[model samples]
Target: MRDFMDYVLTAFHHKTGWNVDNSYASLTTTANNLLDFNVPHGLSLHVSSLSSPNFATSYTLGSKGVVDGSLSFLYTSLGLNVTSRSSHIPLANLVRGYRHLQHLSLPKGKALNDVQDGGTSIAGDGRKDTLLYGRLYLPSSSLEALYLRRLSPNRLLRLNCVSDATLPSGGTVLALLQNDFGKYTTEYLYSTDSSLLGFRALYNFGYDPRYPLDQQHVSSRPARHPWDHQNGRLSAGAEAYFSPINKSGGISTGLRFTTLPIHTGFPYTMTLTLNPLMGNLSSSYAVKAGPNLSLCSRFDFNVYSYESDVSLGLELWQLSRPRVPEEVAWVKDLIRPGWEPKVAPEKVVPDEDVTGVLKARMTDKGKVGVVWECRLKELLVTLGAGLDLKKRDSVVGKFGLEVAYSS
Candidate 1:
């Protein structure tokens, strides 16, 4: 395992002008037990200074930049079975400091029950299983970010055909099953900038939407089957800041519009904004209004409504960061003159055997869209309401609130 890891590290250094190091020897015995490794586990760390002269700060100049890659492997044997697991985390950053990051990856593997007991047949035969997981995080700032994750689990089973097999009535069976889950999210925010119109756009795509806010909810049936399904969603919106611009202690206002697309539908959309500090404080006056629309089966419907959201809160400090430098350089290099990266062309293969065909058809459709948002100091709140105008009309509403500490 150590020799294999060294080979990997050497390859990375040869391909990219970056230094690689390892701390596997420093790993404690307890950590090894956690991984169920009888032998000591290996660890490696890579570091490359951006200030190095040999390192190309920008890829646009056809320069080899700094890169970091690490991998870990472990193998263990318990009573009657052995397990193996590994993890690989790789990051590539531009030599020249850029606010954004170019590439980041986290990959993991796990294998359980490599071998099972044959003599003792319980309710079900013990099976072997393997899990693969990965996640990527890119946060440009508090207001802008992108995230992606994927997971797959595979199982192998062996079963006896009959409960009591005195005769040849029992048969042996082997089965294999696999499940997959994934998610992608991106968001951008513009904070009342005078030069550019205040705007924000948020998009979320995933195989499963049930766990919109939970990051760990990878599979759908965690308690029972513990497998997730294919689900995805995309939503985007923009807002303009207005009123009380120069005033320090008075009211403020803004305008907003957004659209959401989930499943096989046109879009559920809404537009609205509000102002709280401008009017009377004692009998606070608020205004909320927006147009709503929905489309299904190529049909479109629209509606308009008015509502208000009131809240009291405090102010806090806001921090922001720039985009990943390496990614920026990569984009620049892609547009540079005489710069080209060779990419192998894909081979076209035809399916010779005929199998069952599948088709998808859309029938009934509906949409309801309404949105309202307000923030007071440390507290933030939003409300959305819509109606599906189809053969069967339905109403939908969601409420969300958030609080943060202020300085």
Candidate 2:
């Protein structure tokens, strides 16, 4: 019965699809954890899906809380993606006190507009692509500015593979190793013929000196000449600026330029991002509001196309946090004694905080949307709605109910 319910819920969740930024009838939504379950067996499931009018369906799944190894798969309207991941491989585990991780992803799908004559039939066969990623940590000591270093495939640990007569299948794509200096850093990635050089400085980035999470630069050129001097994709921009301890809100900006022989449609582009967080707490309730906004501009060297959007999200965290009792009981009457407002959320997982986010979004074209999410014990519920001023847009939405018996 549990398995049957799990299947039904899985299918329903897949069919409805919700978004973390904006979900449900303006009620409750979770940020990072959309759907998560830990089974007694060695398997865990983490699923998140989103769908809107005119846009293709997308599904993403990530494994969490696993102690040792890793494996993941993702499917979309375009095609299928598979990944092999591990932290303690045979090679990396030989040395004690040294921890490392590696990941490789392969995706298969059709081209941008590979449609047939009659209609747009679903086809999953197109191009084959692969990306390899890895990171290693070394001991830190007196004479090492390169402590906890990295040697990834590319500057960003991703590469594009193409079959050709001029290039070998598996030699070396690109190699990068970064050096860290207090309040600043420098890096140099190179091969026999190609090289990339870069540098940066900051005040109080507060990054995990050992394992920095914000290492991926979306708008920066490391190699004076990109991979093989063939793919000319480079960007120059300012690094992210973080705020003080009191308020953790800041702004990031970037500019990217590409020089390719075939495409003259888009030459350069610029982006700006803002992230702000506001917190509220009382004796009985906790609320949090964090909004992320972004604006982008594209210049073809002659004409310019600009766009912008904003997502406003709020979360209701706890309801008077329950008190721990000496003896725990799974089955108890919801109403005990004097009860004006009958009952509160049950204590299924003791001391675990329950969170729900309600958010809204507005596009540059005057389309508005709202979403809500809530949690009652182990059950999750979400709903959403949308409206367009022009009355021609499709209002993609999610509304659902779920019930289960712990057998």
Candidate 3:
């Protein structure tokens, strides 16, 4: 068993450039054997440079033990043009077959608009800022045939701060702001011997302030304008899943409603996915009718399979929207009262309707296996071609190589 597993893993690694980023010297061979002990732990670190001055480094660590269940951590840093830097971190914990908690931290530099101007005209400032966000989740699981189970409510908390300074003649002035946002979400999930249903509700609240732009022109100039806007949103949704009937595939449908109290009307969305042939084919359709109208459909078909080792498939998607009165109202709202929305005046009418369509097709040729592996190793390689067509526009072609791997 050990030799067979090793061969499979080695083949997968070679084909997919496994561990291609990190310096392998930092990892020990024992890392491969840890999985067999029923203790799955893995770490991947990598660094790459773009051109001579831009680079990025990423680290991912995860472990799954019988007692602790699962825990994972990730960190990433990106640097470009010696002037910009950004970093983010995310962590997750799963216990008792449920996702229990997650945390995310993202810190970014000032807007890079200043870099475009040739000289440091006090505009292309790249200052660093830090932010942290976190969430906790609870899930329900059935213990035995006699007892029922229920999941606890979930909670999320987020905090972020921005500290940036401008280089001005007056002196260094600290421009700093902090804000806290939080939400509580509860979900009821139900499943019988063969079907599933779920409903969820969420409440959210948050606030943040915007700062005035700094003026660098020495002479007398109007003080930078300070504008602030605060807002909140509330949402709820329900979903149902049905098992396949006979040889036909399953079905799932969902609806979501959202409201922005300050805004006029509530917005809602509906989605549905159906598999007619329990075989290797599926179709999905969705329509969003609210402030805007959008229609979308997609079809997927699996063409061939080889000993569960390789597979080939094709997919197509179509999206379309019709011009309507709401769109005209939206455009008018953007312009001064007397000034009409810019267009061929003859073509600019309140009731005029426009139609737009977008279509895409993707085909997967074939895949070769055993490219590389160390733990749970799999490697798949294939060639894919795509075409994107838009109404009243030139069609675009896309060609690329597809490599897939998993452990």
**Per-residue lDDT over 208-237 for candidate 2, one digit per residue giving the tens place of the 0 to 100 score:** 222222362422434332121222222222
TM-score of each: 0.18, 0.27, 0.18
Q: State the weakest 10-residue window (summed lDDT) of model 3.
A: 89-98
Error of 3 at 11 (Å): 27
Name the lDDT value of residue 22 in candidate 2: 14
> Each prediction's Cα RMSD?
28.2, 24.4, 27.7
* Candidate 2, position 213, lDDT: 28
Q: Where does candidate 1 stray beyond 4 Å?
A: 1-108, 113-153, 156-327, 335-338, 342-367, 370-383, 387-407
Q: What is the per-residue lDDT of model 3 for residues 1-407, given as tens digits with 9 covering 90 to 100?
A: 12111222222222222221111111111111111111112222212112222222212222222211111111112222231111110000000010101111111113322221222233433422111111111121111111111110011111221222221222221111111112323333433323333333332222211111233232244432221121122222222334332322233222222222222222221222222333344333332223222232334455343212112211111113444434345455556666532221111212112121111222232211111111111222223233333422534243433222222
C-alpha lDDT score of every prediction, in listed order: 0.22, 0.25, 0.23
C-alpha lDDT of candidate 2 relative to the true structure: 0.25
Candidate 2 error regions (>4 Å): 1-182, 185-355, 369-389, 397-407
